[model samples]
Target: MPQTPLLSVVVAVYNGELFLAKFFACLEAQAIEGMEVIMVNDGSTDGSMAIIDAWRDRFPGMLVIEQENQGVSVARNTGLAVATGQYLSFPDIDDDFKPGMYRRLLDLALASNLDVVTCNGNYVYENNRKPSRPIFPEDKLQSTGVMSGPAWLKKALDSRKFLHVTWLNLYRHDFIREHGFKFEPGLRHQDIPWTTEVLLAAQRVQYTNERFYDYYIHSASVSHKPDTDDTLIRSARHYIKILEMLEAINQRYPEQVKNIPACNWQIAKEGLGILHTFNNMKDPQKKKMIVKEFFDRGIWRLIWKNARGFRLRWRLGRRYLKLKKATRVPG
Candidate 1:
């Protein structure tokens, strides 16, 4: 039997031919032994498979899964099911990371027996039009210490800059499996709730100041695309689900009192985001439908109940009044 690899990198590829070569090149540069790369090709019509095939020989532990195009959430969940490593990472195919990134994270995880280890990264814009920006400020991570996951989450949320992206961190396989944490299939922004749950459940989490990952921002990215009526509706629904998930988590772990306010804040943010999306929608009929749906689902009450701080509550109230008057929807 083969020894278990130290880490597993699960990437969901869908029409990512353009970036596969460079992504593979970055992985090769890592030079980390006993690292398994699981590539789930979600029915890519492009030459993505060809590029993956060309690089198959580079990693002895590489595994490839081919499946129908079922969206990224399903693709990632598929890869997560079969991963056989002590640690796990989910990275985008179109992104690259600095050399020695995983090695350092793995070493830290091993040394401290951490449930989750996260590091900083840069947001690299396409065409170099905008300069890269560090995901976290150096001052925020200067302590470089291990703390409870909820504690770390509280600090991060207080900073108001915590990102929910999965790729910035490495998680213990057992911790993930023990919780049966799987990305919701067909749900956009699944990372928000997933990350929140993981952090809340993690007993030992650490952060490093090392800027390792490069999250490339380009016009072609799914997030950058202009929101259509369908996409907006989906996004609104997704945020509503996130708010509900946070409430459930808060109730499930009542001892995590310090974490509850932050969680509620997250709920408020998502609620406001939904309201903003609804307000910006171009179609009046669609807007009316979304407003009615939000009220019917009691999302406004969720925001009002969970929203922290006087200013935030005031903003929510003001926005609700404006939206209610504009749409003539019930208070």
Candidate 2:
């Protein structure tokens, strides 16, 4: 009988032929025992499948699942459904991790019996042409050692340096399954709400300052794509949805008093992102429609109610008045 692996790394691949070799090389170099890699190919039209097939021999424990182009959420959820490991991680194809990253994380998780363990990483820009910046700078994160997920989240939010990326953390499989957490299908910027909920439900969480992963920032990356009408509208709607989700989470976990401030901070930050997206929209008609929806949904009131500081509240208020004036729409 095959022994259950210690860790399962789930990867969602889409037209990733250009980076598969480097990614595979990094994985091979990890040299970690009892680890399985589950690669979900999300209907790539490129030679991504061919590259993955060729690399199969190098990674015998690797499993591949082919599915239609249903976006990353579905691909990741599909991988999670069949994963047979003690711990789970989701890493991007375009990214790489430092040596011993997973080994160290796994060791810490086992030693502490933690539900989640996270480490810091750097953002490598344009394939390292630009100097990389630490995702969580030294001053941005102060709390260390093992703490409940909600406590960790509150401290991180208080520091104003919380990140929603899932790739930076290792999660216990049972902990995730127990909570019935799954990515929201077809939602852009889904990580924001997903991570929020995960942290809220986590019982034992640990944080390390060690830099592990390299988040490559390239023009081809979805985050770097030039904003268009479609992108703006999608982002605006996504932020609104995130705010709603955060509110729901707060209501569900009412005993997590610490989560209230953290949730409010996240809501304010997402509201700013929505305002920025609205400002960048090219089509006046579309922008007006979005503005109307924002008002109709009472998102403006929500933003004002939860916005933290006076400065942020004032800024949002000013933006709201300006947006209303520009759109010439009724309140």
Candidate 3:
């Protein structure tokens, strides 16, 4: 057996042959010490497995595990089971980090003793597309901010200011293990529930306004695609469960913002996106019926109950969307 590592970098690989070499080239150059790379092959039929094999000699600290094709969640869970790192992080196969990122993150995590530390990532795209607005600055390893548990989530949910992905955070493995938190397996939007649970349980969370991770938005990515029926149902279920989870946390700490703020924004944001997805279908009746059924299914109540913004904005947004739709309606 190889020596124990101080940090475990979990990677869930699925058909990532194209970028594997570039990713490892960056990985091999990390300045961080005592790091182990735990990668799971979710039955990649492509040459991803072969690529890992080739790099095994150079990355002797690398731990590779292969399983039948499962969702990213399962692959992560599998990696977590055997990870010896006190701190943990995951890098999506297509994404790469700048040099010295791992060392910087680990140094901050150890020195600060924070339950979680996250930095901003630069969004890179084809033809030099970057995010319109960024929440964090470039390459900052140390971050400082106010601390709140349930109340913090309420504020983010209230203002509709939240991070959608979980990649940038360096998680304390012990904290996560104590809380018994795991990613929702075989489901879309797994990060939402996982991150929500961790944030709610955190006592000291920090942020670094740095750009260590590079989020490459390829056209084939899920966020770029239109939502299907499965996506809508999955998102609705995820919100419902996450709300229940947050409410339970609120009960324990009711003195915070949880006393009055409802989850309207989450419902509205998630549900309306689903509604917009219905438009792409060729059948008008299908779109209309799905929209009606969404309301009939009592989804709006969840949205209505949890909304944090002014009622006027909701009304205005609803009207604007209607006009946008009307422009395409057949005369």
Candidate 4:
């Protein structure tokens, strides 16, 4: 009889041949045992599959799934569908796991019986060869403790220090499955909304200040790409999708999301920023049409309605008026 693995590491890659060797070496150096790594090749035209196969030869039991070129969300969902471990972590091919990272996370998760256990990660720049910025300040996580999902979210939102990326947290598989948690397909910025839903559903969460993951920042990465009109438009559309996902979750668990109004405000603010980018578009007619799509959708009104307090309402109103004035176009 096969014993269930303690943790599953899911890596979703697209044209990741350049990073596979370093990433595989990082995985090999892990002090943790009883873990399985699942690699999903999302129709890479490069030699990524061959790289994965060579590693599979060296490391037995490494699962590889080949699929058509879907987006990152779809790739992640495919990996989740086949994950057999009690705990799960999603690592990007470009990122490297620090020494003992999973061992520490698994140990904390087991000791606390937590729904989620999260640690800090550092952003390593390709150009800068020095230490990177820590996700959370040292004073903020001076001690380790447990908090209800909702409580932790409130504190995290207030400070704006929450690690919204998927890889930073190790989730209990049963908890995620039971809650019906899955990333929304065909969307960028899926992690922001997915983490929002996960935090609201989590009952017990453990946190530590120790940095365990290396987030590589390079020009080629989607996040670090130049913000051209196309990129801004894509980000704007995705933020709208995320806003919708968050609204559904807020309605499902209103009590768990007392700070949702603040979240809504932040999303709306991003939408406004996206709208402003249209001003930089070369085609004036196209810019006007896209601006109308944002305003005609009544996203601003919905955000104002979501604000729960007088202060929040007043703040959002001021921001809204400013955005409207700055980006006005003839109706």
| TM-score, every prediction | 0.96, 0.95, 0.80, 0.91
Clashing pairs in 3: 139-210, 139-211, 140-210, 143-207, 262-306, 263-306, 264-306, 264-307
Backbone clashes per model, in order?
0, 0, 8, 0
Q: Model 3, 94-165: lDDT tens per residue?
A: 877889787777777788776777777776885566553353432223345645545445544544556657
Tens-place lDDT digits, model 2, residues 223-295: 7888898878888888888888887887788888444586887788888888898889878888888988988
- TM-score, candidate number 3: 0.80
User: Which portions of model 1 miss their true places by more than 4 Å?
Assistant: 258-260, 326-331
What's the C-alpha lDDT at position 306 in model 3?
52
- CA RMSD, predictions in order: 1.9, 1.8, 4.9, 2.5
Selected candidate, larger TM-score, 1 vs 3: 1
**Residue runs of model 2 more than 4 Å from their true location after superposition:** 127-129, 258-260, 329-331
> How well does candidate 2 match the true structure in TM-score terms?
0.95
In candidate 4, which residue pairs get closer than 3 Å at backbone N, Cα or C atoms, i.e. clash?
Answer: none
TM-score of structure candidate 1: 0.96
Model 3 segments more than 4 A misplaced: 1-4, 129-161, 225-264, 284-297, 316-331
Worst 10 residues of 2 by lDDT: 322-331
lDDT of 4 by residue, 135-192 (tens): 7777664435988877777666666555678888999999999987888889887887
- In model 4, where do residues sit more than 4 Å from their true spots? 129-131, 141-143, 259-261, 279-282, 307-331
